[model samples]
Target: MNNKPYQRSELIYKDKIKKIKDSNIIIFGLGGVGSVAAESISRNFIKNLTIVDYDIYEVSNLNRQLYSNYDNIGKKKVDVLKENIKKHCKDTNIVARGEKVTDSNIEGFFNINYDYVIDAVDDVKAKLAIIKYCRDNNIPVVSCMGTGNRINPQMLTIDDIFKTFNCPLAKKMRKELKRLGILSLDTVFSKEKPVETVDKKLGSTSFVPGSAGLLLASYVINKIAFEE
Candidate 1:
């Protein structure tokens, strides 16, 4: 077991600290949002983490991704993220899956029995597959909706997907999830109207994605630590 990472958190959460340490969490997507969420969870002494992402970090990702600094631009995302986590939280057990999640392969992804699932992938197909699988299995999950083309960190909030608005990604997801009969979902999303970007490339700022990631991590931590 790893030593408690936050002395102040242990002081307030008390025995919930141990509960956190004992819990297993699996986070999908190692991009701007997922990277920060995964690191935040590790910092809280959650010893077991499963990180999944198929892409390699690119120069463009440095603007928003935590693990995508210039020094490691071409590295596979999950591999670099795993090494970064071990560098900081050495005792935390990390399982890095460097592959995309699809309905065909989703069954293999969930074999670990995670206590919570964080969905941060931008791909709609993969995102829905994860959400549906978690919902069907009765696992707790929090998903992130569209962090791109936005600039306001304060607009972020966690709510059921049906209640979400203003985020175009959330709107599409709401329709698809409803079609699949997945009535409700917990997610972190922004209410800021998306800004138009030059040349059709998505525009994102550091704070928005970073805040969404941390908020998702906070929700998971609170759910496991204080909720039944």
Candidate 2:
């Protein structure tokens, strides 16, 4: 009778549980991808987590977003996520920041000094700001790219941003990062050619986005928990 909340993770990871629990990670964006990543991280007994998002849940989000539901509609993502994680994962210290990360306020936004940063944002400028800030500070970070419009979860791969294919978002980020002389980025990207949408709005799937989110969390956790 394993009575511990995170006994499963503690069991498999063995002596690495404390390192996993001590990881101070911050994730930006709480849509389908980031929300799922937070859940995975929290379940792994990550004790310190910070989730940032300025958006509220909308009716449209229920289709793919992990945290979106009728009860949470119109509620801020960070607040909902914070409430949920704290209630279920009592050992975690969750910080919910309802501010949009932008170029102007980025310095203040990153005041907490996370050991690992996850970029799950959709905005180009916001993503750029986050990567650059982390790069400058020498903090390890991973960015999620183009999970939208992708259907095949198996096609998703984690690699350097420079090598990612079939992801328009990765292509755009490549050009911008090059201009900034940022040579490399740890990225989670889909190799699936996106199914074009007639309305031009990014289409999403519940599985792939959440899968990518798990990949992001796994990458971060592996570094923190398994590294020598």
Winning model by lDDT: 1
- Worst 10-residue lDDT window for candidate 2 reads 106-115
Model 1 Cα lDDT, one tens digit per residue, 1-228: 645457778888887888888889999998889999988998887868999999998988989898788889889999998898888787788999999999989989887779999999999999999999998899999999998998889998999999998888898999999999999999899988898988978888988999999999999999999987
- For candidate 2, write residues 162-187 as lDDT tens digits: 99998888999999999999989999
Model 1 TM-score, 2 decimals = 0.96
Instruction: List lDDT for all candidates, in order.
Output: 0.90, 0.89
lDDT measured at residue 28 in model 1 versus the true structure, 0 to 100: 96
Q: Give all TM-scores, in the order shown.
A: 0.96, 0.96
